[model samples]
Target: MTSERFDAVIVGAGFAGIGAAIQFKRMGIDDFVILDREDDLGGTWYVNHYPGLAVDVPTTTYSYFFEPNPNWSRLFATGDEIKQYCDDVADKYDVRRHIRFGVTVEGARWDDDAKLWRVGLADGTTLSARYLVTATGFLSQPRMPEIPGITEFAGRVIHTTAWDDSYDPGGERIAVIGTGATAVQLIPELAKTAGELTVYQRTPIWVAPKLDVRISERTKRVFARMPWTQRIIRAITDNIYETMINVGVVHYRVPFFRRLNISAMDLCKINQFIQVRDKDLRRRLTPDYDIGCKRPTFSNSYFRTFTKPHVHLQSDGIDHVTADGIVNTDGTKTVIDTLVLATGFDLWEANFPAIEVIGRDGRNLGKWWRENRFQAYQGVSMPSFPNYLSLASPYAFLGLNFFNTMEYQMRLMDRLFGELRHRGATTFEVTEQANTAYLDRMTELLGDSLWTLGNCASSRSYYFNPHGEPSLLRPMSTQDAITEASTFPLSDYSFV
Candidate 1:
């Protein structure tokens, strides 16, 4: 294979990847490639095209800082709307042409002698780059339920991650396993058309009403003409949302704040909660975990779907798949027409492809992670992975607007590049000692939170390790997390 090269290579053309490409253009680094497994540039929005799907975060606040769109039709835009927004950004910034779709990177090995990454593409294409940016969103890969006979099922089984246009839901008895975020959004959509929707909810979700309102045409035109007004609105809205997260999430991580946080919606009838005739269903749907323990969902019509006589929330844990459908642990077997795995994606390797990264001394990132837990300085770059940054790596997930997190990450990356140029540095990597200290600080801080040693039971998740500790997000507010990431002095890295 002939060797080719670029100044930078960005993985996964979602919000992060597209944002990075646009920033690279501003930095005068034009030779860069945006790689994704999908055939389009929307990333997560492209694949997760289920019905009734929309942004949990308010639309005005969940956008790029560089180019904020003041034309959102609703406060909470649908999945298609979000995808179109991403597409619009890609076109506006001229980043779409630079992206190569259906190209999965098999491995990325950093050559210590050459100070470049040896990237192996799935199509047997090998390329080298001076820098690497992993922009794969956290929810990229689908997590299929570990059930026996799932593969042996004679019927069609579709994961929400792999939703195709041809897979019709109308007139089909669908069994959607796992009532997490994906399941919550999909149930309302599927319930509308499916013959009978069997929602196999393992655990109930603490769902709040999605407060979506249509933006008036007059209001939109005004915001367009006076964009600074929109900016002010965005800023204020963002502050309010951040305050909520601080109260709900950051509060849960603290002792005294825990009780005061999660009970805000306990008695409120905000967005109109539906009165279910069945008392048993109401109790089964209620969640016991602190509001921030698991990811919270928002839907206008999720709970009300049970009112549809065809739709049923089966609380009984699915024991096994029989010939046609599933058998519950409670000995109830219902033969479904189809199986839809709305179970969420694996946060770690699925979102960030582990196979590609081969760092110093031919160290595979996956192997390294297996031996040692994922430790990073503010969840951006690992030690020895210089000239490389992750868009949504560990400790960088923002439950609010993911776009905010991407913007913050892109801003820091711009700063890193500026530092490199100032110091005349050809490469910038995290020092081993610096990474160790950062990791120690993060872990020690997390140990103090209610998330790690709180009343919540241990569940192996993106948030926890085998030791059952919170590692997905830093145990602090978004402002605090940014401050923590900024603590690593750029002067520590050496120039060429």
Candidate 2:
């Protein structure tokens, strides 16, 4: 309905997008606008309003490059609070007016000759830009289990992703499925109110206590006085994150090291003692796999919620959903008044939504991914697509806060942009051979990582590849990634 043009257009206004916008502004680059699918900012935060929805990572590290929040209240803020934080960030940076909300990008591709990207919106609108950043985020897609008769359920049903205030599960028999981070948080909140809560867990999850507390007034005053001190603290604590990556992937190569880490996890079962009063229930809460195998859950209240008298646990596969309730493989039918699905988002190769993106030589994304299995050189640029960058690219997961990673990525892209502009290049694209070389090296490095062992029998995690290996997440140390990111050679790309 409206036609406008800009030097660049960014997608999503969440952590990655906000950081990108802020960095772009600081770089003295103008003529850029951020577009979000929601009516407001906060990509995942705006959509997912499930009770007890909170950030698992520490609050100190989860912020921007230019500014930090003066009032973060809690160590790990809830979804609402985080959403408000994002809103506050946009407002603080004065990028809120530049943001175009309630629009979803349907298609985006390189225009080789024109040297601009033609991006189509959900409402049949189009805009062309010199640069395009797909900050659509990793957790945007929600995956509900494909069980028969899912639609025939008679009672109210809701996914944790789309939780709203109107829906009421209070004092009702409710089914909470999946025990990941979101489920871990929501289950505790639900146990306090729901008269009956039956959890259907397919696989066990490893959980750690959220060494979390409110931001102390004294500490806030210190940070407020000297903010660089906060950044210094973040730098020192960053090794903890890098160390976890080592424990996640490297410990598998050494059985003795793996044993030590597992023993350490076993020793941290003080949380189980505090949560589950019953021995059997406590055992059910504990995981059999190595710790940090799955995305390590941080919660002070998760296991404790199961100790409630009304809560029950069912650790079997669901057979099908009947009109009245769910039937498990063990022939147990859960007669529930309401069903709450915590099943994670669709997280596989097939889950990437259909989008029309024709790059050089009319190379489409679907075919590229289908043939090459969703490969990206450093998860930023692909073989055919030119002058495009994906935020939270593949293997971009940092064990700690990823905002810093996103900021680093934005910096890398700025460098690439600098090179492209100064060289008088029309378009820059990566060579196929370089892409293959990078992926080959990455796969070989992940052979002995925990993903290999952690993805073994009884594991149905999304990180595992088709060969049951955990190559999706890079096994290399974060130092290598940062080094590679900082020194991204132009030799990998071609200029038109």
Candidate 3:
């Protein structure tokens, strides 16, 4: 094994890591390496190859502000296209040289006296650095349901994240478990080929119409020529999304404005009712929970896929899995040839389970989060983890577009790093008091949002922790978050 040293180390090379590396290079900072366990980049996009997987958000706004793609073939790019876009960005920015593919960071320990972090790789090689940044996204780990006899199934089984490219599901009976975002996308594609498709849903999901189309050549040419035209479109998209958040969360909770929530629910019913002809199927597909309770989905084909004659939707809870098929609570079994698990990732816990981060006072990062609850100041820095940062931090999820939120976070990081450099500080850590104060404010603010006051628990969303705390979203707008990240005093942290 080989050991190397650097000024900093970045983990995971998807949107967050790639953005971080590009920003660092722009700042004239080198001596850093981006390490990804996969041989390729595009963290989630690289791993998830499920058919019909497309960006839920518009492609115009789903990109980096620094590097805009004027030639997006579709309004919402597919999984392969997005992955290729990430690759193109990396190539254009010359970030590949600094990327160490197929290297997994197993663990990291902070050396207090030496003021360095020793990050251990899976192969027993150690790389030391002054700062450690975890860009490992939330959706890295795919989860499977804990049903009895799941392993005893005789047919081929695969998680959507680990889709087998060579195997074809055409003319075969298939069972898809879980009806989350990934399921919604892959189901429609699988329906076209599978002789029979059984969708097992524990809870209903609210789905909106996906307004997607191929980008016109004229529009692409205009964007490539003017450039400002694309920014205008992006701004309009952002405003529309912000309005949804304001109306749904900020204003909907008011006594006089509760009608907005009702209207949203009515719209959901109408959308589902129009797509599904059967009343019973519509009711089963209709979510009892209020809108915004779960992360709402958007798809043009998902709800319509149910109208297919060969498709079956089962709402009953699974009793167990048999060698032939799955048994329902009512003692009915449905035979299948292939089983697809669409259950989401273990997100409440940090994404990197293998990497045990030992921070100040021998505090393990995962252990601290589990014991004390997950709280990070500005979704970047924690109290004990000095010089360590996480991009997918709790309370950091802001705005309709994830890329926009991440851009704001990277800007804050730039400022923080600038401060560290100016002061010649070896380490920077947020204070416990600051961390608690921010979390308290977030918790109090969320009391008025739908995710907290609405019926999110019944939604079975991963947004909430085991303690029933809605730890996913911030109640404030994206602009508010950007302002906080920008103007918040750096004095809240100690420079050592």
Candidate 4:
């Protein structure tokens, strides 16, 4: 087949890809295409439709800064609402025209000779583009547990990512194999109908009171009539989350922040104390690690669900799955009708690159990351990746809100591409010196974060990669990220 060509090829049709495309359009770089493996856009919002699914972060802070939605029904929007927001954003920005859904990108290699990137697709075709942006979010890949007899089980298996809406768990014995963020949201819904529900947890997640409230129609109208009113709310919500991360997690080493972190833990304990009356069950549910070790979630129902007579928490760890049920490490067994795997994504191994990325000189992006360390210049550019960007790179995610990261990246794109245009260059890449300097600075800053200073040995958080480095989040405030994205020395990148 003939190779399709474009000015840019974005390897995701999610929010990140849409953001990139919008930025490209603003920069007058219109010849770009968005490719997604799913049948439609919305990325995770499009894919995951499990019960009790909602935005963990507040609705005001979850959306793009430029495009505010005043129609959110609640402070914490449901998954369907978020998905609709994605659709609305895409439609409003006209990014839907650039999206090609159900298109799987296998890999991409830098064509040094042609000064472009050759993106390989699953259909045995190739796309040539001057710029390549991998917007595949960190949570794109769903991970299945490495159980002994999961396949042999004679029951319906459901992953949170691919939940079977047709299969009802009402009055059925059910087993959920994880207690991550997804499970925290889903378990309560399962408890309402399941005959006997068991949650097999390896690590306990810290839970906090969800201050969720319904957004009244009057409030939404005020937001719609006065967009600035919503922006103010967004700013307030944004700062609240920023403080939660910067003080509770990133700056844990500080004497003052350390006390605040302890207080935060206590708050979660108080939340659990009120919801869970059984002390022993509460002990089983309580996390031993510090609050920020793993991402904490907010829920009014998660803790109370375990207090139900039909619900059970199995913390001994799963040894294997039998044809009828799961066998625990303590030789205990729990027979169930359905198995729900909330086992989160494989971040380091499978999702770091998400797809094969061969940069200049045949440098395999994943292999290089494993051999050395995961590093990206400002979480976007790499040393060997000319005219390429990965939105989901190391140190890219900021605070608890993803929109903060996306907004800053959009700024970086504006500055970088503006420079490219000014220099009349066709390619740009981060200099080796610049890449190393940024990586070293990030490492130094992370030394003060809770992941390094706090007892995170048992957290089992995806924040720590295979190398045992907490590189997923940038150890700085959202303001710092924005400043760096705008003011970083242009000399850090080479234009050619």
Q: Return the TM-score for each candidate structure.
A: 0.94, 0.92, 0.97, 0.99
> Which model scores highest in TM-score?
4
lDDT of each: 0.76, 0.74, 0.85, 0.93
lDDT of 2 by residue, 1-496 (tens): 3367777788877777887787678666678988887887887888888888788776666776566765677778777778888888888888888788888778886777888888899888888887777777777878878888888999888998888688666798999878877888888888888989999887777777678778788888888888887878666656676666676456578877677676657654776776667887777767776676667677777777776779888886788887779998988798988888898876554333224567778888756665666566876777877877766455555555677567557667777777777887867788998889887866766667776655445656666645455544656665666678779887898886
* Regions more than 4 Å wrong, model 3: 250-252, 350-354
- Model 2 CA deviation exceeding 4 Å by range: 268-270, 277-279, 349-354, 453-455, 465-471
Screening candidate 3 with a backbone cut-off below 3 angstroms (N, C-alpha, C), the clashing residue pairs are: none
Model 1: residues >4 Å from true position, as ranges?
253-256, 265-274, 458-461, 481-488
Judging by lDDT against the true structure, name the best candidate: 4
**Residue 159: error of model 2 in Å?**
1.0
- Each prediction's RMSD over C-alphas, in Å, is 2.2, 2.4, 1.6, 0.8
lDDT of 3 by residue, 1-496 (tens): 4378898899989999999898788767788999999999999999999888888888888899877888898988888889988999999999988998999889899989888899999888899998998888878877778999999999999998898999798999999999988898999999999999999999889888777889999999999999999999888888888877877865556865567777867877777877888888998998888877777888777888998999999998899999989998999999999999998888765463336889988998877877887778888788888898888777777746788778778788888888888998879999999999988888788878887667666888777776777676666787888888788888889998
Q: What's the count of clashing pairs in each model shown?
A: 3, 1, 0, 0
The 10 consecutive residues of candidate 2 with the worst lDDT sum are 347-356
lDDT for 199 in candidate 1 is 88
Q: Quote the RMSD, in angstroms, for model 3.
A: 1.6
> Which residue pairs collide, candidate 2?
275-304
